[model samples]
Target: MPENDRLRNIRKETLSSAWYTLYRYDFEYRRSDGRWESRQREVYDRGNGAAVLLYDASRRKVLLTRQFRMPTFVNHNPDGLLTEVCAGLLDGADPEAAIRKEILEETGYRVEQLEKILEAYSSPGAVTEILHYYLAAYHPGQKEAEGGGVPEETEDIELLEFGFEEILEKVRNGEIRDAKTLILIQYAALFGPLRPVAREIQ
Candidate 1:
């Protein structure tokens, strides 16, 4: 390894486990002004994951999910139930493959084609997670199974389908607060295939 390029004396200690792993990290950093500083921070790592925004252009509708998140609950969220896009941890699988399985379990939509939007860090400050964003076209005919999430995983997920335009309104009004979900909604509004068309006066 190169000597004293930027970071050095790296160390980590495990904090917790279960669905994800938490670690406390310590290292010495070389600042821009050629100064060395020691720093430490705790990071939560559940591994990278994938998410999708499913929409039906014909009906102008979108599919999302609602579920109780323990973290949200403990952090002062009233009910802890969040409305979000279908998503799941990669769990040692490819991003696209993982998302396909996740969507199947969360929304019952058989995704044949998915447009990868981008990859993002959920919270780089303290989370070692990269979220792969995606968008897919879906219709009622594509439903394969009842998508309430995997029962064995103890996921009590609820399927939610709403008007394409109406959901964005909820986002603006502070109803939908999930970061990934909000990103997908704003992306769909600006660049999705189901955008509304404005007609010129005849």
Candidate 2:
């Protein structure tokens, strides 16, 4: 049976809409034993987003960003600062187009060609955000502006560049803790552009 067929009495209530949206879902779920149980879950709909790893194969370097994340700060991050790949909410745009714009807005690199890696949900149990992942090659000549994110959005992003091996070391030492960043780095190590160098170091 389809998953939807196992659910009934579905209803949603908006809990908050100030930022994105928080919805409470009440429904009856059919269990494996054929019993129906009432359940409620709060889901956050912050809209889908995209992320990209900008690398220069010749130089063996990758471009990343540093910014303050309030959620991380409140949880346990020492200073709320996190190093992450360039990313942003899609805001109703296509994944590729959105990521390309984000790359320019956050890194100042206008890359013409992007290789999409995969798409995954950020936090399926609570957040309704499917993040598209991409990889793009970039060089200094592509810099068009001093990208620090949009001023009106209060986004103060700092661009950081690190050698491929240096970044992998950071990942091992627990310095790079962002999930999306980790995913892209691991992908590069296993099968993407950085595979050659990554394998050499291993």
Candidate models: Cα lDDT each:
0.87, 0.93
lDDT score at residue 4, model 2, on the 0-100 scale = 86
- What's the residue-level lDDT of 84 in candidate 1? 93
lDDT of 2 by residue, 48-112 (tens): 99999999998989999999999999999989999999999999999999998988888888997
Q: Which predicted model would earn the best TM-score?
A: 2
At residue 121, what lDDT does model 2 achieve? 95
C-alpha-based local distance difference test score of model 2:
0.93
lDDT of 1 by residue, 1-202 (tens): 3446899998889899975899998899999999999999999988999999998888878899999998899998999999999999999999999999999988777878999999999999989899999999999889999889888999999988888667866876899989999888878777775445201111
Q: Positional deviation of 105 in candidate 2, in angstroms? A: 0.9
Each prediction's TM-score versus the true structure: 0.92, 0.97
lDDT of 2 at 182: 98
